[model samples]
Target: MLNDMSENQAGYAFAWNTPKSAINPYLDPPDPVQKSALREVIALYAADNRRHQKPGESLRNAVWDRYFFNADRDPVLREIAQDKLTGQARMARERQRFNPEQTVMDDIHAQPAWIARPLLQRIAFLKNLSRPGPCQRYLCATVRPCLDRLTRVRDDQTGPSIRQMAGHPGLEGLLVLSDMNQNQVKRLSALVAAHMAGRLESACSLLPLDNDVQPEAIRRVWEQLAAEVMRLEVIPPAFEQLKRKRHRRRPVSYDRIPGSLARMICTTWWYRRLWQRRCEWREEQLRAVCLVSRKTSPYISREMALYKREQRRKSLEFFRAHELINEHGDRLEMEAVVRASTSHPVRRRNEMMACLKGLELIAEMRGDRAIFYTLTCPSRFHATLSHGQPNPMWAGTTVRQSSEYLVGVFAAFRKAMHKAGLRWYGIRVAEPHHDGTVHWHLLCFMPPGDCSAITALLRRFAIKEDRQELGKVTEPRFKANAIDSRKGTPTGYIAKYISKNIDGRGLGKHISKETGTSLRDSAEHVTSWASLHRIQQFRFFGIPGRQAWRELRLLAGQVNRQHNGRKAGAPVLADRRLDAVLAAADAGCFATYISRQGGVLVPRRQYLVRTAYELSDVQNKYGDRSRRIYGIWSPLTKERICTHSFKWKRVRKTSGGQISPGRGHLFTPWTRGNNCPHGEKINAHHRIRVQRKEEETIKDFKNEHK
Candidate 1:
């Protein structure tokens, strides 16, 4: 407006560079009264322009557009005007965005930034190691006033559950928080970035434990971040100690229900081999990009040429420099890796149990220490460690070889027990001696009168009748033990083997970083682990041991009710994997028709028992809500819903709602209430949980039904 008036009317223009003499570049002193009179004339003159007469448009913009020329003598002044206009337009747009009709997650930014990201994601990220995804709508009503306070989030405070969060646009739904007057978007962004770092720490740590992620500790770290929000120059080191504190558990608890405890060398070898092997290709890719520039003399493959060609198109120098600095060394401590694995201690235990149970069984015969029996295989199906190796004989045997033979022995023993109607307990342990022969050691509590008959049957199965077929069946002794009374109980003699099998207490340990990689590799590459994969080294099956085991477990369960929920018999629809697992856990002990019950044993329904420590497992990942309610996607409801039990959480396939969302659609469980098309609010009955390996399957199912 000034430029137009200055050029056309010569009234609005003032000498910008003129000295501040308060004379308005004129000879007369332009006092406030005089300036006001002059501006009134110029304003009227500028308003006379036809271009400023746009109807229904902003008068200020219309006036400015009429007088403000794109090209003017003062470029700086024009630029200033342009900036003012842009700022006003942005403010208007921001104001327009807060419309109650369209509640966007970003609109909360217009209010304040101290809001917690969706309560669900925040809780999961803080505790469950859930992936950091899009943050849910902010809890503005609950958070706005607390921003300046020193109070902590109250756990008892009710907030939207994960289901509610998923069903609504978070902050937009909070009408009461509309009047909040503050800006914390920058602060909020920093908080979320810190959360992302915390998640990364959880993933990269050597071990991620729930104990290390205490709620109080997390709150303290968050408060620290909040206190220094203004001073944060970059992403503050979030959850740094959480990462530092994470490491594999010492004395890995047996309550974790490990399937095997053997071959520490192979286990560690495999882990390191994978870790180092992963870095190999990454480092090679860097080298490939680097070598591309120096590819004059070397002949490369066609695939290699194309890959290098592509790398050239990218910023190779930048990537190569970073790769060179971060590249892993070519070698690693092979033995150190194995020595640090969960399998190390277990290996000792397995080997000791493999050697001890048979001897202990023999020693348990009525204060006896000398009653022992052995079943030796005469033929060599595989070679042992004693056999010279270029190609070891054990390599030819499969994992099932020993297991199959041992299972046959169980069959014969069970058959003998049935005929004699004996309630005697037995223990059988198997191992391959250095001579490449698999042998079984057995101990059975039997009356002297019945011993010979059962012993004869055992010998028949122990040493196959075809002696010539067994290579050299020399000294195929049927009775190798004489019961000699020695002590009050023989269990101690055998208990040592059990202890060794669990922890390898007496076994010598060897794994060294100084050892050559080839030597370590060779030691781990032997066929022993694979051969024994399918075999159970020790077996116990008898009335006495089973009864006592059940009694001890039941007693333990009774003592810790908090960890072990009541042994309620849950109805399983067989929808999810836990149906069978939990059902077995709820049952007692079983009885076989062949074995007679011992006087000390009670008649109980046989069911598999699991320890409290072993019973902890989760099927639903994101479905577990903040209120301690667990959830799963209900196929019948076509949406995620909360359920108390894992079985109830499964999707119900047979049932379908009559009042669908139209067009063969289904409604979410929460939406089905109040506004239902039916007479009464119909419950969205959940179905057998559709067991899905990937989350996408559940998502796709929901989408298809919706």
Candidate 2:
């Protein structure tokens, strides 16, 4: 409008000379204050157009747009402006009018679109959060408070129980906590809080045991009262100890009179009095000897020596007449010596019985002069010397070979004594190796009449075996062969052999440094490159060194040539190659079975075989009857071939659609007593894929339907 008015009035306005800066256009248009402010702004702009307008005319455009409604406007621009203006007005009203207090209650009474949409959604979310039901929800609300107060409920207090008759008022759905006091309510609150915090069971476990109540009632209380919450009750360790303690009868009373006179005469001081009397008798014998020596002097001493000699000779003749002494003058001692031995630790019951039994045996058989000894175990020696010396023995086998051989030798001697029907003795096997041969130094106990028979048996077994071995034994000497050569020097030759087999396999390449390079520096440099290559281009299967790789490739070429022998075609899976396949199958089958049983299955390492000969080699390597290498991809060469065969097929095809599953021959039971005796279970055996009866019936049903 301003532009159009100005164009018509341009000539007249020039005559009137209305200087645009002096006459303000807005002065007559609106409120006086707005008009005056608008004129002031216009006057500032008119004073210097250059000063008001920015170098890019940005400020001038902005000023005109804000102040003027007159527009030579683009339709798009005008429409955009109108929309912005309406939006601003609406927003302003909304911002000024909103109140939460009014909306919250108003929404309940008459839900607007937004409110109505979320009610069902909110219920669903809350219900999911609530879980199980509202009773759990309500119980959840009170549990914490109830638990806090539970501690204060007297230990004798009857804990809560739900008492509802079947088909009665509380039957279907109701929570009635019987015998719940205010304190229990507080405890319940604590319990609920714990439950909310995911410690409900733990909190219940923290409850004091109702020791004051009946044991049965206390047991029932946890099951019943704790039904609404999780609870753990700890049994006292003292109770556990008591349960494990051994039960034994009390010692028989010596103070009380017995029915039998023999038992009645038993008294605590009897042994003490008897020991004193024995000591007195020994003293008297010494006094009498001293008195006799003083009176007879040198004459009595000479006579006594003669008499002792004569008595010894007579005793020897008596033993000889009875065949107690052998022709070699070795005689069987009436009482045998005791020596250290080893045995398994006695169980508690055995130990008690042995103690009583040993005392009885000692009293009946052992004389006063005989010394009795119990064995000390090697285990005890091991414990004592653990920190000090290492055993010189192998240490078990070294000691055993020597000790056991001696024990066997002496055992033969003892057996001879026993065979003679003489139960009157002890024989001990002695320690130490004898003349480089393990032989027992026997101390035998035998009756005077049985000595000759025992000696003869001992001589026959030992001497006969000894003579045969001695006849063959020769002086020790080293035999030299064609061993000292470039190929067989001790260390160098060992290195050659070691490098070829498993002994050298894991040692990797024995790459040496070049003439001018230090081994370490060369290794470091080579290692860096190898590591980079390993990360970048390396694949599983080949040995580490370049030479190993060449050998592998050569081996692979050889396999390929052999495979080509049968004409080029798809390679057959070999035993070694099928390992990964079988492993995958086993793993998958196990995983599926476990999954069905509500467990998880972790997949095994590889899923396929890249080389057939590899499987064949593995089957051959195991050497188990269950595993036969029938075509496997080789790990080294990556060629497939059948290196072996199985007597039975692993998997078979049936007339039915179902493929019979393979049994893993790889896993056989490993235990004694026929636990897993043969390859029957380990090796796969074919069974009918489907029951014939069922299959026939199904076929008949299908035909009938048709």
| Number of the predicted model whose lDDT against the real structure is largest | 1
Best by TM-score: 1
lDDT of candidate 2 at residue 133, scale 0 to 100: 62
CA RMSD (A), model 2: 46.5
Q: Give lDDT: candidate 2, residue 433.
A: 16
> Cα lDDT for residue 404, model 1?
71
lDDT of each: 0.35, 0.30
Worst lDDT 10-window in candidate 2: 335-344
The superposed Cα distance between candidate 1 and the true structure at residue 609, in angstroms, equals: 9.4
